[model samples]
Target chain A: MDRNRRVSVEEVKHIAELAHIKLTEEEETLFTEQFNRILDYFSKISEVNTEGVPLTYHVLDLINVYREDEVQESLGEEEPLKNAPKREDRFFKAPRIV
Target chain B: MKTGGIEEKRALSKLYELTAIEISEKIRNQEISTEEYLYSILERIGQVEKKVHAFVTVVDEKALEKAREIDRKVRKGEKLGCLAGVAVAVKDNICTRNIRTTCSSRMLENFVPPYDATVIERLKAADAIILGKTNMDEFAMGTTTETSYFGTTHNPWDLRKVPGGSSGGSAAAVISEEATVALGSDTGGSIRCPASYCSNVGLKPTYGLVSRYGLISYANSLEQIGPLTRTVRDCALLLSVISGHDDRDSTSVNLAQKDYLSFLQDDIKKLKIGLPKEFFEEGVEEDAKGPVFEAADKFEDLGASCHEVSLPMMSYALAAYYIIAMSEASSNLARYDGLRYGYREENDEGDFDTVFSRNRRIGFGAEVRRRIILGTYALSAGYFEQYYMKALKIRTLIRRDFERVFKNVDVIIGPTMPVLPFDIGERIDDPLKLYMCDILTVPANLTGYPAISVPCGFRNGLPVGLQIIGKPFEEGTLLRVAYTFERNTDYHKYRPSL
Candidate 1:
């Protein structure tokens, strides 16, 4: 964690890319400033040492929940795929990978 | 729109203003037919929807049909569910089969759920009429309803002020008598903030107490679907209907359904109440701060001892809440690539990454995209240890803070919002300042505790919400306190004059 860390314009673009969100030039600059300000506010947390405190990803004490694998009723393509942008033969049509 | 004389107002009060209990009894006793009641509520929505903009979609025809169905059941002398014929306004993020669940985002503008959410199914079984889906912040991302893609929901109390987000529409609908009750999900104060702003009772149940199977995920770990109602008793009735075990949601608690209404008794003789000094220490507006202490004095009058307690970790809760919530949001929202469902890209000539990114960019609003990018950066290489993990560690500290205090106090009390509802566009631009408004409500979400907001008093003619945070899984106690408050005080009886 760099104390003087600031997100550059390219880094914001890269982050948007990683998140699969395309950003306009205006959003890039605006987000960079907001991010720097927010991150600086957030940096105050690093000062406190939580040496042995375990992180809580989920507040509830949940365990590996399992059920008997059995045949069950399922939603057919007609309803589940109703909102598909493009479909063919009860299947979602997607952009070409290559 | 048909109010002229005070006697006519008295006649119409039997329609939309009835609580779940009173309305259901009226239907059962033939004092009012369900169809007639539904028409009255629909007419109420018609009269107020133009001014408040609470609902994204109103199911007038379907609601009438359901109401008639309940009427037929009543005629048959069939057993009725507890909330039979009660009209419920649902937040658009919850799935309603054959109904659009937009989440107030262009991304899900036309998407409808293929099946009902578990809560929706339970509501149907309870014979509660689904009045409509209310508007919300895009993907439940912001503090004010102004981020809604449809439009902002105005506070019925003051049309100039905002109904708080992201459950703004739900709260507005409940307070305006547009609907008897509403279902809302809270991630970081979404339910309670709007309830505070609009002067309704809102509860965020313990994590996993209510099933979240049909809820559109914002922050999967932090959010819970809860009720916003005109009275605490109505809140309990709705909560009883929607909560319980559901195999559809693995996280749903494995306990038998408890009737929260049974917990409402007019007594809190020796309950210990902690007033976290930190909640009132900074940034709280004068009018808002005054009512909480006044409410504390009322609690003392009820024989509950009020003492100042410290939860210093509250200072870091808002920051940690945003980080964890945004991180989960970035991951949970990655599934909306537009091919399978949701807003579609017309020009489909690009490769997979290009199409996905393009759709997401065009689909999400500015705040949604901003949080997603920040989340992606926090979880990215070299920064995970710095931001996301540190936030989680602070989460433990905050939880410990609550645990340490709850051992001494039965419930923690504070103002639900640091200020009254601001003017609609007042703080939307300054995101940090807007986030500050949630400072009082997010600690419960951060700690997976059950909390309720009941109308305490008014601040400068606007209603104030006094928040009571109880121990996890003790929704019964939370209801007891709020119901007692509502019974003794006249605050909950105040209406917005919509």
Candidate 2:
């Protein structure tokens, strides 16, 4: 097991790619150190005796937050849109969606 | 009455009460000019904000323009809305049209929303001045404001101590008079914690009461936007303006609100207030507990009965909150791809991997990235059942614990935070130490109940927030009890000499 190691720059780059983030060289180096330390800390979780203990995620026991299915009126034209750099024909024009 | 010997009249003239209802009344009666009020607050911000660091971005030009428009309308004898020309500091999480809504994360540093958040639209419609975007824990993840990409907000009461977070900046702004009132989002005591630390009033409106359309989601199930002000009346007034159903947010409840401020005047006789025994147990700070008990004494003076109720699982709420909040946050923050919106870098080298690699790494902060990794691991395929599902079941138990207690009491009183405000760097090195600060306030979020943190008393001259937890959608009763406490005590009126 390669336990005595910091995450490689290559590995950090890979993780950053997977996470969809752009990293500067400084960030990659910084996160590599930080991530290694964090991963080391997370290793403590494995030490807990959970032979029968269930892994818990959400604290709220809510089964589902459901709302009654109903149709509602839209704001129609009464809605006044403000703080736009530009607007056109009751719609906010922006950079192409595609 | 004199603040710093600057003359009582000057201090009073400079003082901004953080409620739309009060501001509207004054604006309508021509008691104060909107321009006078707006610039006066801006000047106050300039005076005190250096140490407090309450705002991430101050929209001075826009805020002044909005105030001037309100002044113009008032001069023309136009009918005023509910909160004409009131200055409102928005939490960085909520999207503001053309305004950078960073959520205090590096991810959205340059991202400007193309449209106003629903609450922003509502606040603007009420003729409120958008003061600025206040700082927070990056993506509303931490209990202390230390997790912010912009750095921590100082407690106004004590410059060295922290204002509770991730709504710390908002609470500090209100306390230091940077803005009259500020909008804050609470997933797990973000609003209340800061409000408690800063000696201000903060409310976590019942889930679905306030529209969450434009709020940057930290934890979808737990998040609700509310106000942090200096008085309970301001919270009630803000609630009336912001709480309503919106088509954009399907989870919004269409329930009608009676005048919450009117409900504040109701008699407190025969009201059952629960004192959770588990909260006051050993490990609770002696200083914090003393003020909490004093607050309980005040509640008793208001003709309300206080009884100790047992919530055995309440002890594990902080641990459970972190697990659940991080898991949800990991999922919610996945949207900031840096491709569509928020700080996207130009990647001329064309691979999809390269595009994502350059974008997210530069965009997100260390805390956000850490949580994302933690959440990803928790919600991943194999660990889902062991971690996420089990937490959900325990969450049920936590909620049941509150439900059982609330059945015997109309409200529960406890310390909003378990300790006095720690200095800036006290818990920065230890993440677990930071997470422990939410011990007293996470239960309300876990139970999906409405809780308020109002100024109780001072502990060594620093502010203490007393939390009033009520049943779901029973914000009226919570406000009534809080208002009663505020009216009977001078705790809310205590201003920092700074």
In TM-score terms, which candidate is top?
1
Candidate 2 residue spans exceeding 4 A from truth: A1-18, A21-98, B1-20, B346-350
How many pairs of residues in model 1 come into backbone collision?
A: 0
Candidate 2 docking band: incorrect
Candidate 2 reaches a DockQ of 0.17
Q: Which candidate is the best by DockQ?
A: 1
Each candidate: RMSD: 2.3, 5.5
* Top candidate by lDDT: 1
Candidate 1 per-residue lDDT, tens place, B1-498, comes to: 234688865576559988999999998887788987887788788788999999999999899889989999999999988888999999999999999999999999999888999999999999999999999999998878899989898999999999898999999999999999999999999999999989999999999999999999999989999999998888999999999998878888898889888999999999999999998986988888898898889889999999899998888888898888889988999999998898878888789999999999999998999889898888999989999999999999999999999999999999899988889889888777877888888899999999998888886789888999999999999999998888889998889886
In candidate 1, which residue ranges exceed 4 Å CA deviation?
A1-5, B1-13
lDDT by residue for model 2 over B275-298, one digit each (tens)?
A: 998888876798888888998887
TM-score of each: 0.97, 0.86
